[model samples]
Target: MHILRELWTKEIEEPDVKSSYEYVLNLRERLDDTLKIAREKLEKARGRQKHYYDRMAKRRKISVGEKVLVLLPTDSNKLLMHWKGPFEIVTTVGINGYRINMGGKEKTFHANLLKGYIARDQDTSQATTDERPPTSSCAMPAASVTVVEDLEGEHFNDSDCEALPELGGWGSEETVNDLKYGDELTLDQRRQLEERAIMYSSIFSDRPGTVST
Candidate 1:
């Protein structure tokens, strides 16, 4: 039975031995044509998939001495991963790989497993400066004065400093006014608070190398 052709219809005719041979040869040619078409479609599909993947993938050109975070597995669990290090790129290993200074040791990493590290302090300072009200300039720069006074204190300890008190409500006119503290506190109390803050100002300081042991 010629299953491929006969399955569609009941009407059938048995071929002569010579005719059967020709039919088998014809089927083989048809199969080769079908296989070629199948292979072409597969190649086109692979090309389309590659094009979409390239479009979605992130491309970064990391330079030497630039800081980047690396994706790595945790010590406790190999399956669990996290971004670690703001490690400096010592050199480029290859087209998409970087050699990082993981402390004294160097390790090569693929670019896909690395991302640029941006220091938040600079951005935070800029954002705060921009968002500050114009009237704040007119107000007594008590914090700036205090910071300077704190720097002079030789006994100031970062470990002694406490966490900053949270403002009850943020971004309100009252919150801004309350931050001045001058109008709210008595003269003696304000002086004491300033002395306390100055004694432990190392924690509050944004300056590098300010924290001493």
Candidate 2:
């Protein structure tokens, strides 16, 4: 507008369509000025935003195999149970990015969305023991047990075992007198007694001179 003031006062000639370059140049200059101001304002806004973000931002160094917790939004309106992991890092994906094992599925996450896991002393000890490779001398070749299936008769049928008594306790006076033992018994003793009861159930139920209760 300042540069065009002299031209505006002296323009007494008939408007020639072929001589409109000067008018177009003036409009172009104004448009460029407006664009420059807009760009400056945008840059300043960006700088302020960057400053705010940088105040709380931190450089998190995470490695593969390290455990981390991921930040996740929850269904509840209350801010509870928001973070979900302790998932192991499987691979490093680009800058500030990692691939983690989430219950056997792999998920990619940014560093800002994760936090490092501080394992307890007991947990560290347990993990060390679990992760330690066995020595050559300690690693014995696994023995393959051959299953001998007797197809000749229907022996060792799981369906038959289901029909057998669970044998919780001595159900009758006859059973109590026959065993002649207290209710309190060790696991092995109880199992043996149960097996005996089952065998007796088969024998006495089928034969004579035997009581069934």
Candidate 3:
């Protein structure tokens, strides 16, 4: 306004006015034109920017059936395994501003709380990943034995033979009594059982340090 007034006054003071008056009017017209163009271009740029952001936000959004955890100021809670649940994506709700979810019947949490959400497929072993001791009992190996005759085949007095029973008492009372003075040998008889146990453990070992699902 000041510049416009000064130019006007200068034009008025001029005795010959046509040229100066036209100059000032032209200058003001140029200012209006520039302003109009600038405003139009600015509005167009703003609309384009809004559209781009809208598309970007949509691309980043998670929908129902997707498992996602809500972001928080600190991931410390997540690190500690303090966070809960593998809540499934139940629904979506938002208008591009601060949207939220109505969640599922089980967990009716807000969309902002989506950080608590985790992909069901990936997050699966997350909750139950830790392990505990197995609950089954293992079979025991059995033993075997063989007998060896005494060096002396003839009957002997009490001083020569002690009343020692046969190997495992595996014989009848009369049989054991008859062989009381005989020698016996014993051996372990669980080859098949031992091999089965070893094979069973190795097959289920699942490549060391890996927890079975």
Q: Which runs in model 1 stand beyond 4 Å of their true positions? A: 1-17, 54-58, 122-213
lDDT of 1: 0.73
Task: Give per-residue CA lDDT, model 2, range 97-200, as digits (tens).
Answer: 99999998998999988999987899788999997653322221332323344456344444443444343332333432255445798888988877887676
- Name the lDDT of candidate 2: 0.72
Alpha-carbon lDDT, every model: 0.73, 0.72, 0.51
Question: Model 3, stretches more than 4 Å misplaced?
Answer: 1-18, 59-116, 119-213
Please name the candidate that would achieve the greatest TM-score relative to the true structure. 1
**Pairs clashing in candidate 3?**
67-118, 67-119, 68-117, 69-114, 69-115, 69-117, 70-114, 70-115, 70-116
Per residue, candidate 1 scores C-alpha lDDT tens digits across 1-213 of 465455346334555654665687689989999999999999999999999999988678999999999999999999999999899999998699899999899999999999999877987899999976433112232223233244343443444344323234223223221234568899999888777776766555433454358
The runs of at least 3 residues in candidate 2 whose Cα sits more than 4 Å from the true structure, single-residue gaps closed, are 1-24, 48-56, 75-81, 123-213
Instruction: Please tell me which model should have the higher lDDT, number 1 or number 3.
Output: 1
lDDT of 3 by residue, 1-213 (tens): 654666656745654565666677898899999999999999999999999889866334556666555444445554443434455565554532223332534434455455534344655576466443233343323233544365554543454323433344323323211222213422333444455555665443323355589
Better of 1 and 3 by TM-score: 1
